[model samples]
Target: MTAIPVSAITIVGLGPGSMDDLTLEARRVLAQAAHDKQTVYFRTIIHPTVEPLKQDLPELRIESFDRLYDESDDWSSLYQQIATEVCDLALQHPIVYVVPGHPLVGETSVQLVLEQARKRGITTRIVSGLSFIEPVCNLLALDPFEVGAQIIDATNLAISHIDEVAGKIIPTIPLMIVQVYNRRLASEVKLALGECYPDEWPVKLVRAAGVGEEEAVLEMPLYELDRNNFANHLSTLYVPPVPELSALRLPETLRYITMRLRREPDGCPWDRQQTHDSLKRYVIEETYEVVEALEENDMDKLAEELGDLLLQVYLHSEVARQADEFTLGDVYEHVNAKLIRRHPHVFGTVEVDNSSQVVQNWEAIKKQERASAGVDVHNESVLDRVPQATPALMVAQEYQKRVIKTGFEFTSLQDVYAKLEEELEEIKQAASPEEQLEEIGDLLFMVAKLAGFLKVDAEEALRLANRKFRRRFQTMESLAREEERPLTSYSRPEWEKLWARAKEAIASN
Candidate 1:
């Protein structure tokens, strides 16, 4: 056979499902190629319309290549080979390739052929047909332009990408995702969507649209998508926007208080004068109260205290906004950005083998950030990092740790005990009250340091001791009351006898 000069590679779209749906131009191009004895190839003949074409055009050299399953490992390689064979045939004669629906709409094979032919300097022509998108919209009774719709492929939906799109896209707009092939793929889509949309958000599954035996539209929650057990290669997932639930109005008393506090001229004098700095102590105090409630295992109290702590944050942010320094949004942005930056193991390429390395990297980054902000670095001591307003015992413990880090600390527990004894003797020998107070303070500081070396929290240990003393003293008071004698009227020997009884009663309990 002699090679003929190939003029053009014609690409035709064989509309969705029905033969009548094919455009006049598409039919003309396909028929012309058949008359010219050129090769006529159909991308797929799985549709009912193309099935009739095979019977009617038996002598027309019609080729239906739908038997090649897409789930095969070498599907792309098969497509490349098919395109190569078509290009080889075109070198000897003109060739026509037909694809389902519009050739430009998600038709990877058609795109491959066009691109490869262009590189080989072969002319190409594309004939458009009715796409599945229009028919799908008509069936679902949705207006894409009016409601604002986003179309995406189901294969591309991953957890991270879905989160990104969900956060940025307007919540009012609906989403239409295509190419959901199977139940496994549907499950992945559901998992990704659940990140933003509620699990109960309604979704519609559409399959093999515009065909006589096509599946009926199935509606279910996003979470129940996989449970429905209905999906195929032609399936599309439609996610509807969830409507916000109505919230109850605030109580009249609470509303009045909020209004009065926010009032420009008639607000309370003390409330109007407050700023972020003025409310800082209250924020810290409320946070500690919440922590205490949690430790006590009082769920109801914890809930109430947590709300109070949150209100402190809101109040401070509102005050800052009035001062023109920043708003709650700015505060949130800074903290969120800081968290993401500090956790490079979570958000960046930093390789951290363990939690210890993560902590070290975080501290290093924080120090660098502080240095860059022009905060004193060289002259700044670690002790200064402990906030001045922190509880005195906490500050003492923190200060001791800073000094120990600098290799200025005393040796062992025995050495610390000896120093404590020496401080006690000095307190006894002091001539002035101030000197005696200073010696006692030195003894307490040394005790705190010893507690740190022993891996004990000095504040907590002291708190427990105080509670024990209070309980024992309460028992003694109760005993005196039962004995028909007042605690203050008891003699030294009588009080000692009551104290022993209290101890015995506690041990029995």
Candidate 2:
């Protein structure tokens, strides 16, 4: 037994609601405080240990923050209130702040008190006791370390986004969610876990652990978790691993699978042989497939194509990992940082009147970033940022788009139209095939610039026109087939009639 300094705030745990589990040191500390007529404060007097402790030590001056719970609807605010009051009392006199379970296990009030007290130059000591984890693990007949169990706060998991939860949860391991407290929270937890876990996944509810006859363990499907009012303050839900379903449910599982596929002699030969340079084509292909799915307005195809695109990213990341260049984490970090850094109007204190202003701000931030990174900003042209491998039409449009940011644009649509006409006339006046090619290129460039002046995407406009032509031509071919005549044998008038019929059919549709 060691002496707890009378000048400091000594925090004690009353164990997991069982008097037999309470530490001798905790008992001695309370006795010592009782003898000194010092008040012992409990975070709540509702714990089973509280009434028993009072009966065991009649002279113990016990007080509690149970009234704070009744007064405040928000648990966060209630914990803060208790912490502030406890720290305030510690300033006037030595305080003994007792809570259920180990002070550090899941005691928010104890954590707050410790932080606030220390910041105010007050000393605090933690008297350890058996936490709920030990008894819960014993009841479940599993070792937490062996199962690699994740202990999550039910309140936190209940309120978090599915994506944020996905990043934390791994379905191929044991999960222990603590502080279920009530059915309402259990429902929220059920819905949250359902996002990644099957609704019918088996789970265990262990309540009042280590508290003798009051302790109960119930097994049920995850979907039925909140169907009854069995959940209480001492409840903990244990989720066992579902390895077969993990790949389909968990985001981390995909990362692990990608890594495993690249592992050694037993791994996939094709995946093992891939390099970043070789996988570049797959990235471009998957990207266009995603765009095609979007253009077709197919949600299911979009989701599937997006997964394919994501796989390419994972493949490239794995290759980089093998070469000791970078990892997937670095990719996410760089892009996330860039997004937050460039979006001042959304992330920072900056405000914008319109999207045009947002674009200007983005460009300005990019320039600042390049200059700060010691790039030769003076020698770099804005057009150099456009990827050379983009489609020809897209590349042409991007060139005009970037140059226009420097205020090199036609002030009026009439000027744009005049430039287009001038280029067309030059194309007609060309005397050689080489000059004709050059004039045609100039004409196309002028058309791209005209598209920008009209606030239209030249590439998208061309794609739409191409799709229309394909549809009309397919209709004309069907008409020719129905007439039992070959398209090659059709004369000019016949072709014109076929085209008119196809156009009329398309407009009717």
Candidate 3:
């Protein structure tokens, strides 16, 4: 209902060093703003150009928030406070906001101010000047594109930014980490980068870059970053990419694939139609294939199959997103938190002796997690987690392990054998088909228990057995064809002989 203040906001950069690097357009605007009765705001007056400009324009009422920097550890909150203050002042009078670099480059306050001003229908204009990068290139005699150099802001990093954006450091290119104003900020940058770049990798610390001949470029290992005598507002850490490594993180790529497959109007028909329920079978199938690859010691196939399995994770997360249930980040966070919580030996102060002890600790942590979530673990059955949807053999094996953990297991392997024999005899003496079925079931479950006691994965062992049987039966059939004897014409004795021959052939092969 009121007039929009679009013409009231002006953002100007003070250039890299001082007035010498300031743009002509920026200079002109500052001169006009000096006597216009407008509120002048400097992001900080620490830069050499600030006092010089104030001296040139004595009529300008200059304000600075250097106190906020001294008082707050949170840069984001500090920037928010500055933005609010600027907006409040702009509401009363026009604002000529000045920052050290280009308004959009590593200028959080500038962005926040622009956002607030836009919400009030204010028109904002950016008067460009030389950013640090310009002087840096000249000072170092380096071409940014040739080196694939990228810039990162030290103040904006968080766990949420790890792989979603520029935080995913690809070591194939050189990185220009800016705004490392102190040892603390430098340490944060070093840790965030340490995820991809090796600890001993060499990185450069360029102080007062582009300011003049006084600029210094210090080279040292990444671990020794921020250890220099001179590191302040003018400091920047340069991380040269590792030559052999190309990419660092996979989330961005996985997110891109998921987005493309689910994009509106033009996406894969099969992918678009798939839901979590529809993709469950593929997840199970891909898992088995991965197991097969691992068992066969096929590294190439294993890598490919693992990618297929990870794709299923992305697909499920995408489905969750569409349903407003969760996002990929939630999936990552859940697993990451669980890992850190359960592995107190790694992330916390708890200690362990062996992997067996680690497993015990993991199970205890799981119980605590369940109880925290209001689950009645004490009242829950031992078989509560032996999922019925899993393969019968695995379910039996899981049940056995659970019961054994609860001290309800067979006394010895001999007891297990005795139970197996009793079940077999019951199968032989079954009074009805239903009774025979029960006995057969008991026999298979006993075998599974034996497998568990022997530390074998019953499901995988059964699958291998099935594969071996199929191969031997196929060989027997092939031999029958070679003899030109139809199965209808072969006697039971002839079939037995052929089976023996097949076994012999396999052993010879």
Q: Rate the local accuracy (lDDT) of all candidates.
A: 0.73, 0.87, 0.80
Model 3, residue 13: C-alpha shift (Å) = 20
State which candidate, 1 or 3, has the greater TM-score. Answer: 1
Model 3, 1-509: lDDT tens digits are 22223346788888876568889888777777665645678878777777777787787777888788788777558778988887877777677888887888777788889888888776678888788887776766779888878777767652224554444565667788777777876776777776677789888888776666668888899888856555677777777766442343545666777877987769788888899899999999999899889978999999899999999999999989988999999999999999999999999999888999999999899999889999999898877766687889888888888788778988899998999999999999999999999999999999999898888988888888988999899998899899898867888898898889999999999
> What is the clash count for each candidate, in the order shown?
0, 0, 2
TM-scores, one per candidate: 0.57, 0.84, 0.56
The pairs that clash in candidate 2 are: none
lDDT of 2 by residue, 1-509 (tens): 34556646889998888999999989999988877777899987777898887888888999998787557765446677998999899889888999888999977778789889878999988999889999999899999998788888786687678677777787778899987878887998998898778899999999999999999999999999999999987898999988843648666777888998999988899999999888889999999999889988999999999999999988889899999999999999999999999998999999999999998899889989999999888899878878888987789888887887798878899998999999999999999999999999999888888887888898888888988999999999999999999999999999999999999999999
The residue ranges of model 2 lying beyond 4 angstroms of the native Cα positions read: 1-10, 28-41, 58-96, 113-125, 340-361, 372-374, 405-407, 431-433, 474-509
Once superposed on the true structure, which residue ranges of model 3 sit more than 4 Å away at CA?
Answer: 1-132, 136-149, 152-249, 477-491
Alpha-carbon shift of residue 279 in model 2 (angstroms) = 2.2
Candidate with more favorable, higher lDDT: 1 or 3: 3
Model 3 residue 61 CA deviation (Å) reads 43
Q: How far is candidate 2 from the true structure (C-alpha RMSD, Å)?
A: 3.8
Please state the error at residue 26 of candidate 1 in Å.
9.6
Candidate 1, residues 8-126: lDDT per residue as tens digits? 67778877677778787776665555556656877665555666665655535677555554543443354566677667777777778787778887566666788789889878777
Model 3, CA-based lDDT? 0.80
Least accurate stretch of 10 residues (summed lDDT) in model 1?
Answer: 244-253
